[model samples]
Target: MSSPTSIAPAARLSDVHVAFDGVDVVCGVDLHVAPGELAAIAGPNGAGKSTLLEVLAGTRSPRRGQRAVPGAVAFVPQRAAIPPRLPVTVRDVVAVGAWGRLGPWRRADASAHAAVARSLSRMEITELASSPYASLSGGQQQRTLLAQGLARQADLLLLDEPTTGLDADSSRRIRSVLREEADRGVAVVCVSHDAPLLEAADRVVRLEAGRVVGAPRT
Candidate 1:
């Protein structure tokens, strides 16, 4: 196995800092995730884990620092971030990941549909494709979101609390899927407190008061 430092970075944050209303959330933290690596961010609730993730996702610009990420990035936010009672099916939600490649006016082509189908199968949610996304359990919703991220075929995959509050089996499945994604050369980064996920990570970055305190390996 290649060391994380040996591989070129798929995403990088240099002296990154984020603030909301003049209060800093992420403070001068540098991080880089290599392709085919699973990196987990762990910290207390207000430690700026999610804020740092948003910086890497390029959804939130840092007040002072640099971010380098690929154009093809897939971000799976916490379930609560998704609007409740959306009038869409599981397949429909997953299919939307392809929209970046197909512009606003273009319809999904054959290959795009194939990617959605493959993602659904990979996440073991093909059976739930026709199910209403809002009606599914928390675990099911998480799986659906993972499938959507997979469908994007992105270079960087960022997730927030993927296995939080999940049952044993669901958590195990999600962790395994994350490893599989890394093995397929996708840089996988997740903000999580899940022990199993952290234990399985190639690198675990711990943040305290918006700073990286340690980067320990299992």
Candidate 2:
């Protein structure tokens, strides 16, 4: 049940422009991501990489442009608002990914549980399935967020600095998960400073001062 865009670019931004107040962040940039491709948004701090991702996520509407980001998009933001001592468990958090089909109660069926379990294992957080979401460390929480994203079965995934709190092993695992997703025809666009992750991307896009200044990936 895919749309025409499935054959088109998974995401397409034409003459995209984003600004905060009087300052322009993303200016007249045209970018496209095909299905089964992994593209990395690379730049130094203040390069508007995250802002661009927000635009792609539909959280920030460009002041002017045409956006063609496909459906079934999953976004794992850099920082999430987590309440301390919440009663929700790791499995509950990851199950959010299937909410579109399973509903909030997660009473779908055994397949839903299997999907949740698989994502937990992929993120190496199966042992924490019963653990409280608020009880996990920053790295652990990051991994959980990633696992949640993986369980979504999204056609397009937008991740912002997904490995911020990860160690070498964790980072490697995350990269592997992203690669597997792209291989499964998921278009992955991640903003990262992690060297290995960027190296593993199918294409690399460079941004500077809010404009795509280099790279054929975009």
Top candidate on lDDT is: 1
Give the Cα lDDT of each candidate. Answer: 0.89, 0.85
lDDT digits (tens) for residues 1-218 of candidate 1? 46888878899899998988999888999998999999999999899999999888888999999999865899998773556666789998999887765779988899999999998998889999999898899998989988888888899999999999887877888899899989989899999999879989999999999999999764
lDDT digits (tens) for residues 1-218 of candidate 2: 13323567888889998889978988888888888889999998998899889888888999999889756788998767877767899999998886654656556577777888899999999999999999888788889998888888788999999887678777888899999998888989999988888889877888999999876632
- Prediction RMSDs, each to the true structure: 1.4, 3.2
**CA lDDT, candidate 2, residue 87:** 83
**What would the TM-scores of all predictions be?**
0.95, 0.91
